[model samples]
Target: MSLRPVVDEHECALHGDCAEVAPQVFRIDDVAVVIGTGPDELIMAAAESCPSVAISVIDESTGEQVYP
Candidate 1:
């Protein structure tokens, strides 16, 4: 499954938790940015670690939301 991580700019507060939890998948700057590809587990972990729920993981193959 190809999981893609996307950051919701409106909800992101630059907390960096997503980056801390999965640096390979997320990066902190003005807001969280999806930097590169990673395991589905890591991508989902990054999304779940966001305190603001700014990060969302989508299964590109299925068009399904994988994280809250």
Candidate 2:
């Protein structure tokens, strides 16, 4: 899996929990959150810390998905 991060804008509350949980995977900017590498391990942490359950993790290489 190559790894990918999908954000649900409607579900996100801009709390920055994702960034806090995994800085390398999630970053907060002026407009929206972003993912740099989207590794499964880090992205998983971010998703777990997300209070709003807005972050979804996906593996592009293998199509392996992480459940939130």
Candidate 3:
């Protein structure tokens, strides 16, 4: 299944860890943004790596949260 990544702008600290872990999926500007759809593994990794826990991965089909 595919996963979609989202960044919580309020919680984001501009740490850039998410982008570092999954550059193809995340980009950092004034804040982090989802640049592309990523595989579940990569999305989870990026979400887990977020220092502020600002990233989340959701299952596209089930709408279930896959990562914190």
lDDT of 2 by residue, 1-68 (tens): 56677888888888888887778766777523675775567767777788888877777877767656
lDDT by residue (tens digit), candidate 3, 1-68:
88898899999999999999999988899899888876778888889999899987888889998786
TM-score of each: 0.91, 0.75, 0.91
Candidate achieving higher lDDT, 1 or 3: 3
- Model number with the top lDDT: 3
In the range 1-68, model 1's lDDT, one tens digit per residue, is 99998899999999899888888777777888888998888888788888899887899999999787
Alpha-carbon runs more than 4 Å astray in model 1: none
Better of 1 and 3 by TM-score: 3
Provide the lowest-lDDT 10-residue window in model 3.
34-43
- lDDT values of the candidates? 0.87, 0.74, 0.88
Candidate 2: segments with Cα more than 4 A from true spot: 30-32
lDDT of 3 at 36: 88
In model 2, the worst 10-residue window by lDDT is 30-39
Question: Where does model 3 exceed 4 Å of error?
Answer: none
Error of 3 at 29 (Å): 0.9
